[model samples]
Target chain A: MSEAIAPALLAPGRTAGMNWRRLVPLLLVAPLVLFMLALYALPVLAMLSRSLLEPAPTLAHYAELAGDEVFHRIFTNTLWTTLVVTAGTLVLGYPVAMGLARARTLLPLLLIIVLLPFWTSVLVRSYAWMVLLGRHGLVNEALLAMGMLDRPLRILNTPLAVHIAMVHILLPYMILPIANALRQIDPSLARAAAGLGAGPWAVFRQVTLPLSMPGVMAGILLVFVLSLGFYITPALVGGPRDMTLSMLIAQRVEQLDWAYAATLSAVLLATALVIIAIFQRAFGVGTAFRMSAR
Target chain B: MTLAGRGASVALNSLEKRYEGFGAVRGVSIDIRSGEFLTLLGPSGSGKTTTLMMIAGFETPSAGDIAIDGRSVVALPAHRRNIGMVFQNYALFPHLTVAENIGFPLKQRGVAKAERARLVEEALELVRLPGYGTRQPRQLSGGQQQRVALARAIVFKPRLLLMDEPLGALDKQLRESLQLEMRRLHADLGITFIYVTHDQEEALTMSDRIAVMHEGRVAQIGPPEELYDRPENRFVAAFIGESNFLPATVRGREEGHVVAECAGSLVRATCTTNPAPGESVTLAARPERLRFVDGGWPAPPPANRLAVTVTEAVFVGERCRYVLRTGDGTSLVLKEPSSAATRRRVAGETAEVAWSVADTILV
Candidate 1:
C-alpha cells in the first residue's frame, strides 16, 4: 500500500518536475541580477559608506548639513524646483494623456508626438531649447514676426528656462503612466455614472478622476524623484542663484571634497527613499502601480 | 415601496438609429406603460441593446421622438433623463466602500450626511447586505458585487430603470436566483423596468412583455405566453424556442383556420395572415407538441400525422428528443417524456409523429 501511494503521490509534473521548472525561471534571471549587484549596487553602497567613513567615522557631515546656511538654501531650491516642475507637468500633461487614451482616430499621432522627444538625446534637446529660447532664437523671431512681442525677451539662463526645459523633458514620463491608467478604466463605469443621474462634470469629478488616482500618483512620483537628482539640464539653462543640490554636489566633487560630495549624494538618495516610503504607505503600493482599478 | 405611479411611461415614436447609413434600429415605435416590466429579447446585434441605449439617451436616434410622461426627452442628455442603469459588468466603484458606492447618487443629489448614511444603510439592507458596508467592492464575491450594483442603481429612485444584460455575466444557477430576486424587486417597487437579454427563458420568466427583435426591427411584441404560443413570423417562432417549419401551399380557408397541403397531405393550421389559395405557406410547431405513434404509414393518413424514420433518440434527463426524417428527407424533431413508452422506438426505425391540427402554426 505504501509503495503504491508513494509512486502516485510523487507524480513527476506535480512534484519534483514542477519544483525544477520553478527554479528554471530563477536561474534564468541570475545573470542580470548578479550584473546589477556588481555594477550598480556596489558603487551606490560604496558612496553611501564614504559619507560616514572617508576622513573619520563621524556624523559630522550630517551635522554640517544640519547647520550650513548655503546647504539649506540649496536644499530649499531643489525642493522648490521639483515641486514646480512636477505641478507644471501634471497640469499640462493631463489633458494630453486623456486625449491620447480616449481618441479613436488620433491615437497613433498623439503617441508619436508624445514619444518623439525620447528619440533624441537629452543633451541635444537642452541645446535645442537654448537655440529656440535664445534672445534672437526662432521662438523670439516668430513672435517678433507675428508682432506678438515688443522684444526678443530674456528667455534663457533663468529659473523659468530651467523649468520649461525640465518639463519638456519629463512630460512624456508623466503622460504615459496617466494614459495607461485612464485606458485601463472601463468606459462602462462612466456610462453607469451618467445613467445614475450624474451630469458630465459630476461624472468626471466623481468617477473619472478617482479611478485615475493610481496613474496620477505614479506620474507625481516619477517626475518629482527625477527632478530631485536632475543635474545637467538645470546647470546649462539655470541662473547662478537657482543652483540646486545636484549642482552643489558636482561643485564639491570638482574641488576634491569627496566627503561632502558623498554626503550630498547620500542625502539626496535618502530623501528620495523617504518620499517613496511615505507615498507607498499613503497610497498602497499595489494601487500606486496597478493599471486596473481592481 | 414608495414608487408606483411616479415611474414614467416611455413612448418611442418611429425611433430610428443609423450609423454611417446602416440602420441599427429602424422605425421602432413602442409604448411602455408605467410600472411595467418590459424586456427587449433578441440575439446579439439584433438591435435590442441598441434600442435600450437609445431609450437611455446614450445613443442618439437619427429619426424619432421619445417621450417620458408625455414630454419629449430625446433632446435631454442621459443625466437629465433621470434614468438608472445596471451594466453587464456591474460597474461598482472599486475604490469606494459598499456604503460609499450606494451613497454616491445621494451625494450627487446633495443629500445631507445623516440622510445619505440612512439611505445607504437602507439600500444595503434592501440588498440583504447590511453589515458589508465598509467592505470594498473588490472584497465581495461576484454575487455580492452585483447586489451592490443593483443597490447603487436604485438608491436615487430614478424615473426609469434600464438594465443591459445585468445577469449575463453570472453563472446559470446564480442568474436564475437573481432573476427571481429582480422580479420580486420590480413587483415591490412598482417601477418601470426595461431589461435587455438574449436569453429566451430569462425573458419568459421575468418580463410582463417581451419585444422580440430581429435585424433591427421588432419581429413581435406581446406577453410571454403570446410570443411563445403565437409568434408573429418565422423569425419570432424560431428565436423564442425550438421549432420545426413544414413548408406547404395554402389549399383553402375555414372560419378560423387555413388548410394547407404538406407532403401529399392536408394540414389544418391556424394562420395569422389570410393566405390566398395556391400561395406558399410554412407551418411551424414546437417539438413537444409532436408525439410518436405505432405504424409507418396508415391507410388514409391522419390529418396531422407524418411518416418519419427515427434517426436519433437522445435521452436528456426527463425527456427524450427524437430526430426524424421523412421520405423526402425533410428533418423533423419530436420531444416526448422519457418514459417506458418513448424508449421502445430506437434509432433507424420507422415511426409516425402526430399533433393536433390546432397545434400547427402557419407562418
Candidate 2:
C-alpha cells in the first residue's frame, strides 16, 4: 500500500504534464472575449466612423463646432454648470460622508437614504424636482406662509433648479467614495497627529484631508463626469436658454440630424476622456478606481 | 552636543482615565524626576499605555490631573502641552518624507525654514540616520523607520518625550541595538523620556527607573537593579525578572531579616516589607543567585544550602538552567555558567542549590 501511494503522490515537478488541466475551464470562457469584440467594440468603432465620415467625409463638423455661437454657448454653459454642480455636490456630500463614516448607528439609515433616489427612474426624480421647485410648489408655499416671500417665486424653469436637482441626484456618488476613503484611513493616524502636537484643525488639514485626497478626487471626477452627460434633469427643470450640450444632442437627434448628433456625441465623449485623463494625471488612476469600487 | 537645559519633571497626581462606563486607568500617582529615563512596563491591558496617553494629553483623565514642570496640564490640548510622542506604529505620514515628518513640530511652532532644516539634520544624526531625510518611511527598514520616528519626536527639542512601545516592532537583534542607542541618547541629551513597553529587558537596559504596572496600578517603581533585587510584591517579582517563589512561614526575625521554614527547609531572607512572627510569607530568589553543586560535592563556605534533584537541564548558550525539585516536591530553577564543567549534570541526579540570605527576598 505504501509503494502504491508513493507512486500516486509523485512529486509535482515529475508530473508537470498535468498542469494544462487547470486551464481547461478558463479555455471554455475564451469565446466571451470574441463576443465583446463583436457586440461592444464593433458598435463603438461604427459610431467613431459615422462621426468623422458621415455627410461626405469632411472636418466641417469639427470646424463648425468652433464658430457656431449657439453650440459654443451651450458647451461653455454645460462646462460651468457641471463645475458648479460638482462643487456643490462635494461641499454638501463631505459632511454627510463624515457622518456616515464616523457614526456607526446611522450608517445603515444613511446608506438607505443615499440609495433611495437610485431606486426610482431618473425621469421620475427630475419630474419630482419640477413639482417641488415650481412657482406654486411646497418650497414657495412654505416661504409665503413664513412671510419670507410676498408672492410665489419662480424657482423652476431656471438654472438654479437644474443645479439643485443635479447636486441632489449626484450626491450619493460623491459621498460613497469619500466615505470609503475616509474609512480606509486609520483613526490612529489622526490620534497620532494630535499626540504629535497637532491641533484639531491642523490634524484635519494636514493628515485627514491629504489622506482622503483619493476619495475627494474620485468623487469630484465621478460627479463632474456624470453631470456632463446629464440630460433629463436639465431639460425638465432648466429654461430653454439654459440648455446643456446633452440637450443640444437630443434636439439634433430628434430633428433627424444623425450626423450632427454623432459629432456632438463624439465631442462629449472626448471631453469626458480629457477630463478623466487630467484627473488621473493629478491623482493616480488606480487609487481613483479603488475609491469608486469601495 | 551637550546638555544645556534641565529636563522637565512630570507628575501624575491620582490620574484616572475612563472609557464609557469602564475605567481603563484607575487612580495612579507618580513623580518622575527631571532628566530621568523612566519606563512604564506592564503586560497588555495593564493601563500603562492609557496612563502615558493621559500624560501626553491624548486622553483626558476622568478623575485627576497631570502636571508638567509643576503646572497643571490636564486642560491643555496636546499641541499646546509641547510634549513629543512616538507611537508604537511610528505613525509616520506616508505622504511626507522623513525630513518633512521630523520638521512637522518645528513647522507647527512657526520656526524658520533654515532653523528647521538645521534641527532636522541634527535630529537625524542623533538617531544615526544622517542621510535618510529624503526617503519616505516605507522605503526604510523597520529599525530605520523607528529611528526616523525617534528623530521626529525630538527634532523640536521638547523637554519631555513619550514613547509607546517604540521598539516593539523590531526583531530581537535590532531591538537590542536600538535599546543601546536609546540609552546613549538619553544619557547624552539628559532629556526626560517617559517610555512605555512591556518588554522587561528593554526597560532594564535603558531606563533609570521602571514602573511595573499590573491591573491599572503600579506594582512597583524603582531602579532596574532595585526592582530586580527587591521587588515589593509577588507581581513585581514575577513581572520584572525570573523569580522562584517558595511558600514559607516566618519562624523568627533578626535585625532586618526574616528566618522562615520553606518546603521542609530552613532559610533566612531579607524582608522587602516587614512581616510579623508566625505570619505566612513568600521567599523569592533570582535564578542566577542559586548556586549548584554535585551530590557528593563539599559544602560551600557560608551560604544557605538545600538538597534538590535535577529534573531538567537546558543549555541556553550563556547559561545552563536546571529545574530541580526539593524534598517537599517544590520545583525551583537555577542558572549556572554554561561551561563544560556545568554540563556534566544529568536529569534525575541529586544536586545542592545554595544562595546567601541577602540574595533571597522575603515578601
Candidate 3:
C-alpha cells in the first residue's frame, strides 16, 4: 500500500509542477496588474468613496446637486454642447474620410495633415486657436479688409470659438477610424450593386453606408467620449458662461474643496462609463474595438 | 418554348474593346440565334470574357456595334440592356437572404408585394433550394450559393443571359451536375445563353454550338460534333479535343479527300478546309479513332494503315491507351476500349494501327 501511494503522491507533485509552469506568465504580469490597481483603480475607488461618504457620511452633495439651479444649468449646457461638438465633428470628418480612403497617391499626406494638430500639445493648439479667433486676429482682419465687417469681430471667449477649436482638434480622431473602415470594404461590392440595377445613390445608401456603420459608430463614440472630458481648449477660448464639468472640477480643486472635486470627478467617470456601456450593449464591444484599432 | 430565333437575334458586328493603349478585345464578330446555347471557349487572355462583358453592356466597346433584336445598344447601360448576368464569384449580397437576392430585379422593376413573394418562392424551388430562402449567402455552401446566383439571374426571365464561368468555383462532380441542369434549363426556358469558359470538356458537353476563340478572334464556330470531327485549322483541332497531329505534305487530291505522305509513310485524309496539293499540312486524327489490328486480321479497305511499335501502354479503367512510335520516330496515341481483347499488344511490340479515311481531318 505504501509503494502504490508513493507513485500517486509523486503524480500530484508532477501535476503541480506543470500548473506552476503554466502560471509563470501570470506571475510575470502580476506587477503591472498591481501597479494599475494602485495608480488607477485605487484613486477611482477613493473618489467614489468621497462622493458617497464625505463630510461625516452626510447626503449633502446629492441634496445640493438636486436643488442647485447653477449646477442644473451647467449640466444641461455641458451635455448639449458635447452633443453639438460631436455632431459637428462627424459632419466635417465624413467627407474628409471618404476623400482620404479613396485618393490613391495622396492618402498618406492627407492622413498626416489630419493628424498634424494631434501631434502638438493640446494647450499649444488651444493657444494657436486663441490667436486666430481673437477680436484682433487674422480672421477679423481679413473680414475687415474684404469689407465683410465694419470692425474687428468679438469672436474669442465665446462658445463658437470653443466649438471650432474642439472640432478641429477631434476631427482626425473620427476621420482616421472611419477611413480605415471604409478602406476595408471591397469596391467590387458597390459595382455589383450597380450591376444589379441599383443607381449610384441607391448603392451608397443601401450598401456602402450600412457596411461602414462600424466605422461611423466608432467615430461617434470616440468623439463623444473625448468631448466629455475636454478641458484645455474650453478653458482657454470659452467664456466663463461656457464652463464645462472639467473646468468646474478644476475650480473646485483650486478652492481646496477636495471632497467636492472628487465627487465631480467620480460623476464624470461614471457618466463616461455608462455611455460606453450603453454603446457596447447596442453594438458589440469587440466590433467597436476592432474598428477603432484598425 | 417559342424561340423567335430570326427576330430576337444577338449580333456583335466588329465589336472592339480598348483599355488605354492596350486592346483587350479587338474586332470580334459573332451572331447568336435566340434560344441557342453558345459557349465562347478559349485559353486565358483570349478575350472570351471581354466579349461576354461587352455583350452584357458592362464594358463599353471602343468601336463597332452590338445590337439586340435589330436595335443598336452600344450606348445602353447594363440595367437598360435587359440582360441577366451570373458572375464567377457568385457576387451574392452577403446582407440579403436568398429570397431577397432572387427578388431584387423584380423589386427594382416595381413588382407588387404578393407577386414578388410568389415569384421568389418559385425561383427558390427552381434552384431546388425551397427552404433556404431566408438564409444569408454566407450561411450557405459554395454550390448552394452558385444555385442562388443562377436563380437570381433567371428569376426575371430576361431575353438574354450571360454567364462568366458561373460553375468555375465548384468541384468537378458539382460542375458536371450544374452543367446538365443548365442545359435542361436552357431547353425548357428557351432563353439565349452566352457562356464563357476555358474548360473544353464543359463546352463540348453543354453547348449547342461552340465558338473557339484565339487572340481575340473566333477561330472556328460549329456544333459540338462538327467541331470535333472536322476542325478548320490546327488551333481548332487541338482546342476542341485530344488529337494527334503529324506533319504531312499533300501528295494528291481525290474528290474532297487528300492523299498525303507523312514521315516516310503514305496516308490518306479528308480535307475539311481547302489546301492546295503539294502544300505542307497537318494530318489530324482523334485518338479514339485508331485501333490495334492483329497480323492476320482483315484490313479496313480504303483506309490509311501504318505498322508501328507500341512504346507505352496504360489501362485507364474502361479503355487501354497505347503510345505507338513510327519508323521516323513520330509517336501516335491510340485508344481502344477494354472489351477488345484480340488486338491487345504489350509495350515494345510492333502492331498495325489502322483508321478510316473518313476519320482523318487534314488541317
Candidate 4:
C-alpha cells in the first residue's frame, strides 16, 4: 500500500501529466525577473547601446578611451587603488574573521561591530572620513595634541585618505565571507592535523589557512569588485589627480557628454564582468553568495 | 604495512578535566601497555572521548600528567607528542586530494617530496586503497573517507594511534567489518592504540583490554573475557552486557563463594570483596546462564535454584526468552536454547530455574 501511494505522493504532478509543475519553481521568480529586466537589465543594455549608436554608430569613443593617456593613467590609478583596498581589507579582516569564527561568547558583539558600517550610508561615511582626514580635523588634531605631528598634515584629497576610507567601508564585505568560510570548517580537522604532528603554526598554515581559502577568495572577489565602482569615497577623500573610472564617468556626465560617459561606463562594466567571470570560473561564485548572504 | 615493535606505552596519571561547576573527566588513570589496543568504552557523557582527547593532547587535563614510554609529556603540545588521531567524522581536509591529505604530516615534518610521495603510496596500500591519490574527499563514500583518514593518521608512523569512534558513523555491517579490519591492523602494526567508543560490542571485538567508563570515571578495565565474566561493579555488569539483578542479603560463605538470600531462596554468587552477613547486596546473572530444572532430570548439586512462575515466554529464533517471577515478585529473565530436547514453558507454569554458582556475581 505504501509503495503504491509513494509514487503519487513523491511526484503528484508527474502522475497527473502536468508538465507546468516543473516550471512552477521558475514561475515563483518570474515577477523578480521581470522587475530586474525593466529596472536594471533594460537600463544597462540601453546605456551600453548608446556608447556605440550615439553620434553615429562608431567604436571611436572606445578607441579614444583605449588610446587616451589621461584615461590610461586614471584606469591604472583605479586598478592600483582597488588592489590596495583589496589587500588592505584582507590584511585587516582575516584576524577579525578568525575571531568571529572562534569566539562563541563574543560572536554576537563582534558581528555587530563588523556589520556596523553597513547600517550607515556610504555618502555619510565618506563625509565623515573627510572630516576625520581633513587638515586640522580629528586625526590631525589628535596627532598634534599627542605631539606626533609638527603641523597639520595634508591627509585629505590624497590617495591614502581614499584608501583608508574605502578599506574601512569595505572591510565587512571581506570579513563576513571569511568568517563564514572559517565557521564552515569542522573543528576536528585542526585537532586531527595537530595529532598528526602539526604544530600551531603548521596547523594554521596547512589546515586552517587552506580550509579557509574559499572564504578568502570570496572576500577578495567581493572587496575587489566593490572597490572598482566606488565614486563618492574617492571623489570626496581622493586628491584631484587620484581620479577613478567612476568619477571620470561622472565628470563626463556632468559636462553633458553622455556618449563618453556611456562609453566609460560600458568599459568599466565589461572589466568588472570579466573579473567576475574569471573568478566564477576559477573559484565557484556560489561560495561568495553563500558567505556574504550570512 | 610492516609496522612492528613501534608501540609506545602510555600512562595517564590522575587525569581530570573540569569545566565551570562540573567535571567532564574526573580522575581517569589508565596505564596502557606497549602495543596493546586499549579501548575506553561507555555511553555518551561517560568521559571516554574526553579521556582520549587528554591522551591525544588536544585537551589539557585539569590535573595529573601523561607519560609516553615513561617520559612525562604533560608539557608537550599535541603535534610534538607525535600521536596519530582519527576523529569520528573522518575529518579529512576538504581542499586536499587523498594523497595530499595523507602526506600532510610528512610535509609538515619536512620529509623530501619524493619520500613523501612514496610514504603516501605505501600508506594508501596499507589501508587497502591504491591509485586513489587524486580523488577529492567529497567524491569518496563515508567508509572510503574513513579509510583515507586512517591512512593519513598512520602515514606519520606515530608510536601511538588514537581513534575516536572512527566507525561510529558507519552502518552496522560496515562497522563490524571495520572493527575486524582495525583488529587486524592493530595486530599487524603493534602500535599502542588508544581507542574511544560508546559501542560496547565494538570495544569488546577490537581491544586487548577494555576500560568501561560511567559517569566520567572508569568503572572497570580488563580483558574482554574477564570484564564479561567477572565485572567488578554494578555499572560494569549492566553496561558490558544484558544482566538480571536481584536484591539479596549476604547469608554466609560456602565453598569459597558468598551465599546470599533472595526471594526466600539461597543463591551462591562469586564476589570480589567479602560482604558481611546481613549486608544487602545485589546478585547479577546473565540471562543465558539460567536453565530450567525439572523432576525428570536431577537438579545439579552446586547449582543455585529459584522457584519461579513463567509470566511470559518469547520464541526468538535461536533461543526462548522466558520472563519469570519469583514468589517475592522479583522479576528475572531466563534464556533457554530452543532445542527439541527441552520442553518449552508457557505463562502461569510453575518451574525451577537453576544456574551454576560461577555464573552469578555479587555486586
Task: For model 2, state the Cα shift of residue A12 in Å.
Answer: 13
Model 4 per-residue lDDT tens digits across residues A20-128: 4555679999999999999999999999888999889999999988889999999999999999999999999999999999999998888898898889999999999
Q: How does model 2 score on DockQ?
A: 0.65
TM-score of each: 0.94, 0.92, 0.87, 0.95
Superpose all Cα atoms of candidate 4 onto the true structure and report the RMSD in Å to 1 decimal: 3.1
lDDT of 1 by residue, B73-111 (tens): 889998788888888999998768999889888887899
True contacts kept of each: 0.80, 0.65, 0.27, 0.94
Candidate 4 per-residue C-alpha lDDT over B1-363 given as tens digits, one digit per residue, 9 for 90 to 100: 667888999998988999886899988889999999999999999999988888888888988888999999888989888888999999999889999999998988899999999999998888888999999998999999999999998898888999999999999999998888888888888899999998899988889999998888889999999999998898999898889899999999988899999999988999879899999999999998888887334545347899999999999979999999998899999888787777878999999988889999987
- In angstroms and one decimal each, the interface RMSD of every candidate reads 1.0, 1.2, 2.0, 0.9
lDDT of 1 by residue, A35-148 (tens): 999999999999888889978798999998999999999999999999999999999999998998898898998899999997888899899999998899888999999999
Q: Where in model 1 is the C-alpha error above 4 Å?
A: A1-22, A292-294, B294-303, B341-343
Identify the leading candidate in terms of lDDT.
Answer: 4
TM-score for chain B of each model, two decimals: 0.95, 0.95, 0.94, 0.96
lDDT of 2 by residue, B74-98 (tens): 9898878888888888888888899
Any residue pairs clashing in model 2, and if so which?
none
In the order shown, the candidates' Cα RMSDs to the true structure are: 3.7, 3.8, 4.7, 3.1
Q: Ten-residue segment with the worst summed lDDT in candidate 4 chain B?
A: B294-303
Write model 3 residue lDDT over B155-265, tens digit each, in one string: 777778889998898999999999998988787678889999999999999999999998888888989999999898889989888898888888887877788888777
Looking at model 2 chain A, report the run of 10 residues with the lowest lDDT sum. A11-20
Which one wins by lDDT: 2 or 4?
Answer: 4
Q: In CAPRI terms, where does candidate 3 land? A: acceptable
